[model samples]
Target: MNTFGMWRLARKYDKFPTPEEKPYSPFNRQEPQEVFDGTQVYSWAAGTAEFAHRGAVLLRPLPEDPAPGRWLGYKDTVRGPALDWHTDLGVIRLVHCGDSKAATDVASAITSNGNKDGVVTVCALYGDMGFHGPALVAADTAHPGIEYEASWGDVAALVGQVLPWWPDLLRLPSVIREWKPDAQAAVVEVPANDNEKILCRAAANDVFDVTSRVAATDMANSIRNNQVDHTSHEIEIFCKDGYSETPNQVVAGAVPDTSHHPLPCDGDREALKAGWHKLALHTHPDAVAALEVAVGREPNLLPFGAVTEIPVRPGTISDRWTQRLTMCDPTAAHAVLAQDDKAEAFFIGPLTDMPVLRTPGDDGKQVWRFYAPLSLPAGGPELASVVLHHTLWVITSDGHVHPAPCTPTEHLWWGDGWGDRASEAAAVVDQLLDDLGATVDLHEHWNAPKGLTALFNEEHKKGAELTRAALLHARMTPPRTR
Candidate 1:
């Protein structure tokens, strides 16, 4: 029963259930539609299912020790413990009341039932099959008393043992999941194009802490009762769509106060009017200006400049190695397209900060120039390819562009093919940690602090992947010269 309830609640929100509980779920059943069909047997099968569905949002990870003096009574014939989850109040149970007479019947049935002693029940009373709202009746069967609360007459509660826990179940997280676009709304359209972009920080089923949920309920009640004129909180929203909080103002860039993106060129201006394309705007002001001009004119153009800050700082590279590395300083002014005849065919910059850009030659055909980052003593990996939308392009110091012969995942994990090379990867990262005076050796201490291990591992793995991809792109690709 505990396993079944886990499946039922987890199914409400699209979170994966544990491996052990997966097979027992109705989702795996041959006829799941029949099992989920809205019938009295289905909802009241274990009696806890209805309230479990009702208070599903209030579920939390089960504490090591549940509070003493409470038990959940399942429906007749159903067995085992309650769901392996808890609420702030205690374990959850359910009591069903169909009408005024059924409330007394439910109380009598619960008190008479030997298994229901000291059980914390959530009573769900419905006036009729059609009438959904039920009056709040908090009852404690062990004490053999019941209290009727008139304020929440439309609310539901458990029979004979419910009042204490019913309120906590109603305290759902007050996150706004949907907002219809309105001319007068504070925030307008969520800006997104064909390309996948993160629109909001909050997810649809984000869970809040108990305190926040209680505050949300209070705030919601206040607004519903006409206690406040406006919303309790003011939220600042950023969107690319030309809608503003104030009339006649269309603020742009990352924040509302930031200046607008540069005006698009003649060709790009028409493209903008046509519709939003798969483009990521550059963060640097000059890069944004250049991207605006190149938007519609250039084919397969990647936006120049840093889109986001690199997570890790650049490692110390020798003076001679710096010269060998192209655009080692991300702040260096690099052009996407050169009007003069004497510019390099391509610009390959730091994998962390800048993107590799290719330009068309005199033959009116595109050519790529690749530059690989210096190899360390470990010979860990080299820059090989640039992967975009599953298409891999090999980048090399050979001053040419070609299609990568392998997939990005295969390229990154190619070293793993020669037996277990994870220890080698760990050793490579340990040297990086050693540079910072840290005495950590990932190869030796398997149980090192997570943060310390992650600090070196994540950067090393990411850098290694980029290097491998770039190297593959540079070496294996066949140049298609016009």
Candidate 2:
């Protein structure tokens, strides 16, 4: 359908019949014109005001207090009456309906009306005014086919300044911002040969020509303002390809990238071996905080469960993968055993070369080399592969965080299968220990260690008392995957 000179934002009502049923038309609809005797079309100031953005005076009366009343077939509190402003070109009306369904039905009936020559009925669906589909349905009829469509916001953008009535209705709780006032305020006269007449004529013409470039320009501006930016505030970056005092860093935004930076425990061996920069000695709190936010937890420089004198609180370190790497390995006792007797001295050193480190990059740039626990062969697959992945984080002196790279692995892709295998292996170990209780209980004797001769004599008696042939026959087998 072509652009029309008249427009109306109306509500659907069940009492109202379609044109086929009742043959109704707003042009011929009659109302008591005696009420609008002394009331003037109120003009509100723009910029946070309801309408009148471009200093244009509103042609409609200010909405009165919404009270309990009935409109069409629905019973509810009502605002102002349905009001219409007529111009030489056409007329625009605001017909407040009882509910959203009534508003939609009224709009559909009007759009589907055969005699609606210079009329455009818009169904103002506010809830879904941001999307194109809903906007189209709101602007067009929901009958056999859609005639015109635009979201309520888009319609507001296209003619909000010129046709301020509907936008004003949108601010209220009612579906149809009604048009006609009470009987005392019904017979509203035309603008008395002033700028208001010129403005009303212009609004009528604009609403008529709404299917033109003017609407297009407004929609373009709205679309530009509604675009989404997916940039993250804090990200883990990586070292650049070449070296410099201020080496350039590459963003790892969801990309597959690896870091060659040295770990805190490995000293400079891994760095030298990988030909990357040495670990930086200091930590930047801001950078650490950013890394924590990106990784969802604070990075532990030392392995978990490592005995320390510093009175570390339990659950302070939540990274289970790093914890298991050190906790499950017997040789990792060095991390727990203190070498000095100082009050603050604890064996807090990293057991494996897996803890994250702050390493110096080219120029004054520092990179956080985060080593996640991949696999601890010494602790066996169950403990070693607890966290079979690593992430890299790089921080520069300028304090900007780069997005971290995500490198996918088989264990991460199919974790459930790996977890089941690990659980089965652990269960087997538990079963073996339970069956060989007395034989394996020798380690418990160390709490009160006797002399070597006494330990040997006790071991000899226990061994002789146990059935050697039966023990040799009993075997523990790990689960095998086909």
Candidate 3:
């Protein structure tokens, strides 16, 4: 057909004549300015102001009667409530939506047409402008008046300087040091007309630029005022290279380079001799307490457990990797252990974190030796490796814990792939023990007593050996090749 004829023919059977829907187009959209009123943007701060840390604190009107709330969502080991996964992720996606659509984006919506009977209020520890997730209400019965809030990291009782609201909301809640309201105020600046571009740039990238600057300013002031005392905890560090008296902060940041520091308990050992460190935290119970306060129980790979006498609290001593090897107030006391008659000292931190000691051999010359459990012919693939830690500590009255290089008993590492090849791995361990016995004496204070040691005595070694076995198996296993 001709062009005009085809057009007419196609038009004759079109659904448009019967009023069909048309496709959407950009022209169909309306101006967003229709309901946007700057004056209508009444000052809205999410939570009540219990306290402020200068710019860190956005002063909000206090609630008439703030209700007392309990801390929740914390692991039993941690002192405070945990921060939520989203807070850790630091994701922020703002949307322009009304009450109905708002629920889709925000876990807890703060605005209501002003009928305050729905959601109960709570003071959260650390959150972005105190905005918790959507109110804890059922979808069908949820009310607009009640704002939703569920924060993980903030324990209500925790009090510290203000933290920045950012991609990730991290709060440092310790005892509040010197208040730096003046310092915080000094850094607060009104963005100049020329600084619009700078503000825009920061907005594009750093979610918490202003808050960061404010925090930095406050922190600087604290330092200048001598408030942030960078006190070092006295410790005797031992490692393969050498032993030295260093601060806790220095070694806390050491790379957990397992290759260089394969903690006897953490991985396999082929060479009977290994290099490790002894961090002399034995004398500093206050340092220990500071460490516990600083760590507050994050995820730990291995925790060496023991039951000690002081107050007799049974707990695990392990590396709190997240504390980043920090030092806290020496005055901050922690519960220390003291046996009925014996010197009670427990190994603290991760096995890999301590300093390596120079062990003395029976040969008299300086030796690189680790006294570990001797695995005799025993059943199970489990006994194929050595334990993690082999030393117990004794704190002196004078607060000086000299590193005593002790070998203690430990098993030898044999390759895996046998379920009950006790004979194979055990024989290897026996031979190692015989060699060490001939070369080094076990009766010496450096080594633990021979034969099957007590459960408490071999506990650390057992844990270490198991971890070593697992790690050894992983290392020994050949990777799949295409």
How big is the positional error of residue 94 in model 3, measured in Å on the Cα after superposition? 5.9
TM-score of each: 0.19, 0.20, 0.19
Rank order by lDDT, top first? 1, 2, 3
Model 3 per-residue lDDT tens digits across residues 1-482: 12343334235534211222344568877443222111111111122122221101112233344343321221111222212111111212211112332322232332232313222222222212222221111111122222333221131112111221211111112211211221221111111222223322322333333332232222223222221111111111211112224211111111111231211222222210111010013223322332232223210111111221111212322121212223322111112222122222223222223311222334444322211212111222222233332222211222222111122232222223243222222333233333322222233222222222211222243223333334244334533433
Give the C-alpha lDDT of model 2: 0.25
Give the Å error, residue 212, model 1: 41
Per-model CA lDDT versus the true structure: 0.28, 0.25, 0.23
Q: How many backbone clashes does candidate 1 have?
A: 25
Candidate 1: regions farther than 4 A off:
1-321, 325-413, 416-482
Largest lDDT belongs to which candidate? 1
Per-residue lDDT of candidate 2, residues 96-143 (tens digit): 332444444554555555524332333333332223222223222223
Candidate 2: segments with Cα more than 4 A from true spot: 1-150, 153-281, 284-287, 293-350, 353-482
Alpha-carbon deviation at 64 in model 3, angstroms? 42
